[model samples]
Target: MISSLKRFLIGRPLKSTELGEQRLNKKKALAILSSDALSSVAYGPEQILIVLATVGAAAFWYSLPIALGVLILLIALILSYRQIIFAYPHGGGAYMVSKNNLGITPGLISGGSLLVDYILTVAVSVSAGTDAITSAFPALHAHNVMIAVFFVLFITLLNLRGLTESATILAYPVYLFVVALFILIGVGGYTILTGQVSPELHTPMGTTVTGLSLFLLLRAFASGSSALTGVEAISNAIPNFKEPAPNNAAKTLIAMGSLLGILFSGIILLAYFYGIAPSEEVTVVSQIAEGVFGRNYVYYFIQGTTALILILAANTGYSAFPLLAVNLAKDKFIPRMFTIRGDRLGYSNGIIILGFLSILLIIAFKGRTEQLIPLYAVGVFIPFTLSQTGMMVKWFRERPKGWLPKLLINSTGALISFSVTLIFFLTKFNQVWPVLIFIPIMITLFKKIRKHYDEIAEQLRISTCEEATPIQGNIIIIPIAGITRVVENSLNYAKSLSPQQIIAVHISFDKEEQKKLEEKWGQWQTGVRLVSLHSLHRSIIQPLTKFIDSIERRTTGSNYQVTVLIPEFIPKKGWHHILHNQSSFLIRTVLLHRKNVVVATVPYHLKK
Candidate 1:
């Protein structure tokens, strides 16, 4: 029944040959991989306002310059990652690039950073999506965390259904969001040109809390860099694209970057013209929609689509985290189960783990986007710097054609990424300090897991020069509680082994039971030795293991093997097994570590 339910939800298992058909085309690929980067425009401009809003209305205009700076850095990163795509089309993303060019430590650093970043991406995206929902209908504000968690679970199930299928389900909403934003931009632009609406009057946002300085502007830029977090996912998942994956992935990246730039810039400009300020309950995009279309259908249409796209944006993290985990698992950094594909050909373990982690963050922050944003950008930038640095080092070593231009592009990206990392540390040290501690701890854990796997392999390796030892004899020992049909089956199975001798050992907690069994055995005349021992403390495993130990110690010089046959009764129903004492299970569990001891189970299935 459980299997049937699972099959119904995730569909029947796909054949390995069907994997090629699961790869996505360019249009669908954009919706699958680029959703996080594109949907970020919903809250990117507002993050800048959050930081600049600290210094009063005068500092608000500075958001435009800071936004342009983030855009320039965005272009540099796109060019840098495109070089990565052409060079390593197999698609390990930053972790693969860093491990190859740099050493294992740097690679693990990149891998760990990315894993944490992907979890945060889901948390931030869904929380922001919840904000859009509540902004339109204020009554839902109290249930934001519950709403965010529902979307995470929903997206996780969709992803587990397979890549192409989820892409088809999600692609329409992304295009709807893009089309909706362009309409907002076009209509808003028209209103300004025709003087239907005048520039919004600016109000001072209370007294200046902090004096405006160069540091403050950089802080705002750092917050705005959240827009660039998911940009490298395209390069990381090159294998997920259709045939001619490199060309298709590169084109998708460019297309995604173009859309992201246009939408992001348009939102920022409109917010500025309309004098939109970041509100706790209402978002900047929500405010802009209200200003342009009022409370009409178009306004609600924009709100609904914005919420849908933002929630689905977590698909980017769902796609990339599992793919990255597969690479790490192959290298023995993480557990091997992450590499296993589910019934629908998705990495089910990684997807489920990502969902749980994102839900934890949503609940912890109470679905507040502002609180989560501080933890968001730093994880991605760490990988961004390392990946670009890895590429820069690769160019100098390989010196491929056009190495100089490639080197310049990656070098600039690396520098800008490193600068962003530094700014995040300097400015938001109070909030982001936990992430600084998390990366190194994760790297250490990766090394420890690798070391454990290496030690296990060495212990299991066979010796090629050693000769095999031959056994001279065998002894079969059966532990019996009473003379029942299960005991008879065990005795017959032991006889079939044709050992030198068979001994039935019983540890009796009561004297009357011990006598009754001996009398029955004598009357049956089984012609096997019956050894009875008294357990003062009624301990079963302790006395039985000791008797086996005495026999092995006595036959130390002889090449004799000892085998224990355990008799078990199989229940008719699944829950019926709980009614029995399970003595066979206890003996088997204790005897597994004994040297040169073989254990076998003789089962008698009950009809009723």
Candidate 2:
């Protein structure tokens, strides 16, 4: 029933051969991959306002310059990552680039940073999307966290359904958002040209708090850099594109960067002309929409599409994070399960884990975009800087054609990205300190996992075994609670292995029970030896494990393995298993650490 329900929701599981068809075309790729960077315009200008607002109304004039600065940096990063795409086209994300060029430690650090950043991306995007709704409806403000969590879960389910399915479904909202933003820009530009600003927005322009300073300008620039967080995702997910994958991915990057530049600068200008100020009550985009559309249906349409696009923007993180995790797993940094494809051929483990982490951030921050924004760009910028640095190093080593110019470009980008990383640290260290703590923990974990794998490999290394080597003898020890059908089946299966001897060991907590079982075994004449033991403390696993240890110590034969056969009964229904204590589980848990001891479970399914 569970499998049928899962099939119903995500469709039938695709075979491994069906994975090749999951590639996305350019148009659908843009809709799925670029949403995070593109939808960021909804709040990018407002973040600048948040920083500059500290210096009062005069600082508002500098908003355009700060945004332009961010744009210049954006183009530089796009060019740098374009090189990244051409050079390491098999999805040259920070993890791969840094690990390849810099080393494993640097790679894992960048990977950890990106992992944290993507989680924050979902949190911030969902919170910002909820902020849009609350700005319009007002009454929904109290339910922001709940709404953001629901959106995260919704995106997770959509992703698990399959990649192409989610991308196709999300394409419309992205298109709608782009169309809505352009309409706002066009109508707002018309309003400016006509010199007919709304009365509600065009108020007295006076100094209220303080004077503008260079510090405020830099802060605004740093905050506005959030717009570039998801820009590198295109390069990271190059494999997901259709044939001519690298070319398609590069084109998509340029397309996204162009849209981001135009809309971001255009929105800031509209807000400037309309005199939209950053307010605690509503978003700057909300204010601009109202100024242009005048509380009409277009205003609500803009609001609804803005919310939709922002929520769906989490899809960008969902697309890239899992793929990055798969890369990390291949390097043995994270769990191997992340590399395993789900029934739908999607990285469902990473997707579900990302959803849960994003929801935790939602609950922690109460779905406040402002609070989450401080923690946002820090993660991405760390990777951005490292990826560029890795490329810069790569160019000098490989000295590919046009190395000098490409080298200079990546170096410049690295400098700029490094500057932003430092700025994020200085400006919002309190908010972003968690990332600082997280990276080292992940690095330590990676080393430990590597150590364990290395040790296990060494231990399991096989000696030279010629074809003349004879089969080794083995002994089977069966632990049974009674003379039931489950025991009969277990002994019969043990006979198939052709063990030299089969011994049935029963642990009795009561003396009377032990004697009764021994009498019954004698009467049955089962041929298998019945070894009865008394447990004074009523401990089943402890006494049984000791008996196995005594046998291992007494065994004199070489090239022989000691095996313990555990008999288990499977109930007719899933819930019925819970009615019985899981003795087999306890036995294996203790015996797994012992050397040369194998515990095998033999099951007899019960009919109701």
Candidate 3:
């Protein structure tokens, strides 16, 4: 069943060389890698305002300080992770970092945290995009769940087709959005500077300027930190880069960081300058555009393009999450299936799981951005904290002479990143603490499962003692349906074992077949005893097991062993064994349960 499902979902597997054919160039790779980071510009500022709404519009200015804090954290994280790409460019990201430095538990934590973050990256990006689309088209505002689900399905299908396919499709719109955004920001800034702003700039939503407090500032900082959610994608995706992975990865990081920083900062500043209100009814970008180019075709075109980019940005998570899970699975922090690559060499199972979970989140939140934001930064921060801590350990362990400048830089990066992580934790905990607790619990469970697998693997290891155990008092029993070459082969193999006694057991599911089998066995001159067992229940394993137990009771003595020879029958095509025959497997499992009994199969090929 599982095999069929896998074949249906991913099709036949491809070889590594075929997989290599799907390798993405740096340009395509960057487009895929930067999707999540670029998507942030669409809604990162809106998230800040959503949080600041409680404190009023005056608190919206807090986005500046918040954006600054996030920027500092982003720069530090990028620099610290550049060293990671240099050190371990094979691309395990947080999992490799934590495993190499902080041990398995920390590795699981980082892995689980990153997994959750990836799922949320998809959910949040899609939800935010859907919300923006709804804002533009009020009809969609009422059907948010349907809209979000459709987008999730679209993204899932695109990714399943392959990363390069999805990247090629998304590249132009994202690039167009970036250019349109720059143009809007440039035009808006010029309009504001020349004091040619629209009348709506002075229309306030009853927001009064109030003195800022530490709590409010921290809240703003936490909200604005959404921009940093996608910064780690480059690290997670380093392996997908072309030859010279570290150089490509470092270059990708720098490009993503610089572009994201400029776009994010520009959007926030433009919104603030144009007196854009933070309201659930209106997005800041739309408001700023309206203020700058009120109801103009160019403004609507840019808005539409921005909405498309936001939707496409979720593609970044679609590209990265599966690869991240594959990395974790390789390190034994996730299930083995996650490590299995598709025809495209992407972690297809992980991608499907991510898509399913993101869809669930989108459904649960009813595609509301406001509802999902609370859970957004929690998972990302956990990995940020652990990754920074791991880097600190990496720095200390590899202490190099005359590398003071590098050491100091890493140390400062660690300090700033760690500090921001703490602030994010404290500020977002009330809303996101549940996810923090949930992630650790999952990591603990994963470790326990890994330990169990290791123990089972140890027990299954082959030893010479097992192969050298001498056969003593061998009694052979052959299970038969009727007279055929399949049965004859089993009888011959039983004789070859040179058993002290040989018995052929026939299960009577049908009286006529049993009578014919009995008559045939009576005529056979193979010198084998015949025993018939009645199975009123019409089950094979239970009746065969009872006969074996009866034989064992008759010969209870030291060094006595029972060898059961089972005839193999092909029901139809050869692969039909999987589709139709399960009784043979069940009998083998039941027989193996006894210490003295060993089951063997004699195969009879069916003519094609």
Candidate 4:
């Protein structure tokens, strides 16, 4: 029933040979990979406005300059990542770039930061999408947490269904959002230019509370930098593209960057001219839509698409996180389980884990986008800086054709990225310190995990110089509940091993039952020793394990080996197994860890 349900939801499992067919073309790839970056325009400009709004309505005018700073950084990242796509076409993104050019430490730091950013992408994007919904219908504001969590679950299920399938399902909303925003910006710009509506310099909302300073401007820039969060995803996911992967991926990155720049700048300009103010209940995009269309159908259309694209933005994290995890796993810095693909050829484990973590963040922050935005950009930009520096080092070391020019671009990007990271750390330290500490903790964990894998390989290594230990004889012990066909079969199987000695033992809680078992064994004329252990506390496993431990202690380091053969009767139906006591399973689970003991299960299937 479970398998049938799974097949129904995710569809039938595709063959491994079908993996090639699953790779996406540029159009579809843009929607899947660029959604996170594209969706940020819904709230990215508002983040800057939000930070600047603390001083007064007049400070909201600073949002334009701050957005242009973010846009400059975005251009640098796009250029740097395009180089990354060409250089490391196999696609580990920032993790691979930093690890290969720098050292393992930097690599892990980049990887850890990307991991954190991906998780935040899901949380922040969904929370923002929920905010858009509540903005549309004020009555739904109370249930935002539930709405955000449901979106997470829905997106996670779509990803698990398969990559190409998810791209197909999620691509439409992205294009629709882009078109809708273009219309909003076009209409809003026309009104201002044609004098249909006069531009307001002051928002006429909040009073003057504080003064504007350099630190405040830097803080606003740091907040707006969240717009660039998903830009690295394209570089990380080059492998997901069709043949000629690098060129196609680079083109997609350019297209995505172009769209992002246009939309982000357009929104910021409109917000400035229209005198938009950040609202707690309604999003900045919703306000812009209303200003242009005045709560008409087009207004709701923009709101709906904005919410949709934001919700779908989580797909960027969904696509990139697993790919990065796979690279880490291949390097032995993480568990190998992440390297395994699901039935749909997606990294199901990593996808599910991302979903779970994002849901937790949503619940913890009460699905508030403003609360979660502080922790967003730092994780992404740390990798941005590291990746750019890594590439710069590569250019200096390799000195390929035109390496000097490439180095200059990357060096500038690295400088800008480093500055943004520092500003985010200093300005949002209270909210973001946990992530600063988390990256180091993650790096330490990566080292420990790598060390453990190395130790395991060394221990499991077989050397030609080592001598093999020979077994002198085998002493087989049959654990029994009563005189039954299953016990008889287990004894027969044990006898086939040509053991030096055989003993049948039973845990007898009642004296009368013990005597009856002995009498029955005597009547059967079996030459095996029948020792009955009496448990005062009525604990069967304790006495049974004690008996095995005593035997192991008596023959420590000897050539002889002890084998405990557990007899279990298999139930015909899956659910019927729960009806019986699982003593054999419990006994086997405890004894399997003994050094000198070999545990075996002898199953007798029930015809019923």
Candidate 5:
């Protein structure tokens, strides 16, 4: 029944041969894998306005320029990764690329960074998704953390249902979100082009800081680059695409990049022209929608779709992180458990771990999108820089037909991403440091795991000393407390194991009890040797432990096996065991530690 329920929830387990059925085409892949980049438009422009707002409304003039700069970086990343798709078609994300070209240490670092980035993608996306709803209805503000966590769990369960199923489930939201935004831009654009622009769009005031400095502009650009976080995912999970994987992945990458660029630039300019600023009660996009459509049905539609798409965007991490974990496990940098697919052929361990880590982040950050925003951009950029840097090295070494352009393009991406990473560290040091520190610790853990696996592999290899030899015979010792049916059953089973020698032993605290057991054994004529040991301490486990230890000493270098048969009666009801003491458990625990000892339990259930 339990297995049936699992099947019902996650679908029937797939055969390893069915992996091809799970491979997605470009359209579904775009919706499944590109949701992260697509959903970032909901917050990327707002992040710019948020940082710019620190300098007050006057400094908001730089929002367009900062967003445009991020747009350029996004394009460079897409172009660079397109070359990556063809060069390393077998799903070479930053970790694999860096490992192939740079070295093991850089590869480990890139893996750690990308893992953190994927976790943060889930956390940040879900939190921002919850924020979209809260912005639409302030009454739900208090439940934001709960809402965000629920979204993560829901997406996790969806992915566990299998890739194609989840892609189908979540694909509609991406289209709805895109359609809603286009409608918003169209209606809002009409407002601006016509004389119907709200007069407030042209007015400005509220200068918190006196001057607009390069530091503040750089800070704004750093924040806006959050949009670039999900670009590498397509590269990371390129293998999930159908045949002609490289071209499909490249086309999808270009399309996602182009769409995000359009949406981000359009939204930034719209928000800029519409006089929308970061609000404690509403999102920047929410404000823009309302400012254009007023408090009407279209406004609610935009808000609802935004919330759905933002929440579903976390599906991007679900779809990609598992594949990354599987690859890492194959490299032996993590536990082998991740290599096994679940009922739906998803990497259940990785998806579940990502969900839990994201839950912690949501709870720790109180589910506020702005609170998590500062820490969100750095983890992703590390991989971006490393991936491009490695790709440039690949171009130079491989010297493919178009190596020069690809190398220059990747070099440009590497420099910009590295610069952004540095600038972000300076701007958001307090938040960035935790991730930076955590990354090295993760790399160290990976190295330790790899080292342990290597040692274990060498040890488990064919060796003469530990080679198997058939068991010559068995000496069974039955710890008989008193003559009972359970003991009778244990002795009968022991005779089958080896009728040559079976000893029924009793640890008695009183001579009277020992004498009674000896007489009873004589009457039963069980053909089992009766051995009695006096226990002044009245402890059952200690004396039994000593007997096993003495046997181990006698058999020092021999293959003679010593089996300790512990007779235990099964109670009619489970709770009846609480009424009866668990001495057999104690005896087995004590005997298990002895050399050449096999502890076995024989149970005779009561007919009650």
Candidate 6:
């Protein structure tokens, strides 16, 4: 059943020869790494408005402060993660950062938080994308779940085909989204600025003006910070960059930060100028698009294209999650399966697991981006908090000569990040704190389970001397067939056990081969005794059992323990079972039911 499920999930495994070498250049690497952050422009504004909806139109202005706050936090985090990439250009991101600076426990916390965040990233991005697309084509709104499932499967297949294939395909859509959005915002802003009569778009039908309070502002800020989700993905993916990994990663980080800042800021400004009101029902971005382009063909085209970009934003998690899992496995925080590369030299297991979990989340939340938004930021913030704290520790521990400047910078970044993390937790507690609490609990349990497994493994290990411990007995039974290499090797290995006496025992069914075997045994040395039992009825287990009983009865006065050394062969070809068979298995099963008998296998390697 497990094998069938595995086959179902990953499909057929490709051969190593079929995969070829991974040849991602710097440009391609940056594209693949930046896709998630770039895609955020689609939903970031929408999320900000969703937060402000609870407090009505007056609180909509608060989005500016909240967005600016998020921007400040983004800058600090980008700078801090830049230092991280410099320190760990080989990848591992939060896991490596916390593990190196704070210890394994903190590293595991970072790993768990990053894992949850990545999965959420995929689900939230894809769902929000689907919502955007549905907004343009109201007819398909009912089948949002189906569309989400299809995209998830499609992306999963693309990733499985290998990174380069997926990156090439995804790069164009990401570029189109960026260009279309910038064009719309630029044209819309110009039209509004030049005193051209633009459509006075009203708020969505159901929205009303409700008064705001302190708590509402905090929630709005927390929600707006979701735009900051994919900012750290590049830091985790630095190892995948071309040679001079640090420089390439730093450049990618700067580009991502600059692009995200402009795109995010432009969307917010455009939404505000166009009078895109807060809606508990409809996205402010969609409303802004409708107002700018109306319900005409061009507007629908922009909406559809924007939705596609948002959906592909989930691809960021696809690129980041596996790398995080690989790093966690390296730190022994996660299972070693995550570290095993597939034929394409990507972490296939981790990727598939991420895909499956993201699907579950998409289904659980019923594809509602607003509902999942709160849960989304919690995990991201936890890692952000720990990573910043870890960076502060790193800055102090390895203080360079001109250290005060660097320390102040890192400390300030750490302070901002950690403070936002605290606010997000406090404000989002009712909605998101459960996940924050749950993730750490899981991390602790996983660590305990791993420690327990390690202890059991240590206890079960066999030492060399145990293999050579002498068996005290008057009679030593060495089960043999003909004088084949398997039988000879078993005899030699059994001798290493240093039994008090040695006897070569055989059960013969055919008279002709029995006579030939007896003649061969006649040439053996004096120290060894030969014993043969007649099994004319052709039953191997019965004869062996009777002979062991006879030997035990005769040696009642001495310490008698029968040691059976069985020669076993393992096949080279997985499908060669019909050609060769093993008899030691049957013998071992029968001997296990007997008293004062022990069985050991002496493995024989077969020629290819």
Q: What are the Cα lDDT values of the candidates?
A: 0.89, 0.87, 0.76, 0.91, 0.85, 0.75
Query: Across residues 1-608, which tens digit of lDDT does each residue of candidate 4 receive?
Result: 88999999888999999999889999999999999999999988998988888887788877766887988998988998999999999999999999999999999999998898899999999988888988999999999999999999999999999999999989999999999999999999998889877645545434343588889889999989988889999999988999999999999999999999999999999888888889888888998899889999999999999999999999999999999999999999999999999999999999999999999999998997566676778888888999999999999999999999899999989999999989998898988888867888999999999999999999999999999888888788888889999999988887778746788989988999999999999999777888899999999889988988888787787988888889999998889988999998889888888777899999999999
User: In model 2, what are the clashing residue pairs, if there are any?
Assistant: none
Cα lDDT of candidate 5 equals 0.85
**Each candidate's clash count:** 0, 0, 0, 0, 0, 0
Cα lDDT tens digits, model 6, 1-608, are 67686566555566656434343556666666777777777667777777676666545666677788878877887887888788778887777888889997888878888888888888888888888777766798889888997898888777876777778888777777777778778877887789663434324333345676677777777777777888788888776666677888888888888888888888887776676765544566677777778877767767767777777787778888998888767656667899888855678898889889889988887777556667777677777778777877887888867667656666777787677677777777777767757776978876876787688778789887666434465355777877877777777766666545777888998888888888887775435677888897888888888888887787666666767777776567656656775578889888888767777788877776
Best by TM-score: 4
Question: What stretches of model 2 exceed 4 Å from their correct place?
Answer: 198-210, 463-472, 556-559
Kindly give the stretch of ten consecutive residues in candidate 4 with the minimal lDDT sum: 200-209
lDDT of 2: 0.87
* Candidate 5 wrongly placed segments (more than 4 Å): 198-200, 203-209, 464-471, 478-489, 498-501, 504-522, 530-541, 565-608
Ranking by lDDT: 4, 1, 2, 5, 3, 6
* TM per candidate: 0.94, 0.95, 0.83, 0.96, 0.91, 0.75
Model 6 per-residue lDDT at 432: 79
Query: How does residue 206 of candidate 1 score in lDDT?
Result: 38
**lDDT: which candidate is best?**
4
How well does candidate 1 score on lDDT at residue 488?
Answer: 93
Candidate 4 root-mean-square deviation in Å: 2.1
The residue pairs that clash in candidate 3, if any, are: none
Q: Which segments of model 4 are wrong by more than 4 Å?
A: 201-210
Q: Write the per-residue lDDT of candidate 2 for residues 1-608, one digit (tens) a residue.
A: 99889988888889999887898999999998999999889888988988877866556767777888898899899999888888878894888889999998999888888888788888889888998999999998888888898999899999999999998899999999999999999999998888787645543444333666666667788899988889989887988888899999989999998999999999998987787889987888889999888899999999999999899989999999999888878877678899889999899999999999999888987787567676778888888999999998999999977899999999999999999888888777778888777788989998898787778878778867734445477778999999999999998898777646788999999988889999999998888898888899989988888888888877755666789989999999999978999988888788888877987889899999
lDDT value, residue 553 of candidate 6: 81
Candidate 2 TM-score to native: 0.95
Worst 10 residues of 3 by lDDT: 199-208
Which candidate would rank higher by TM-score, 4 or 6? 4
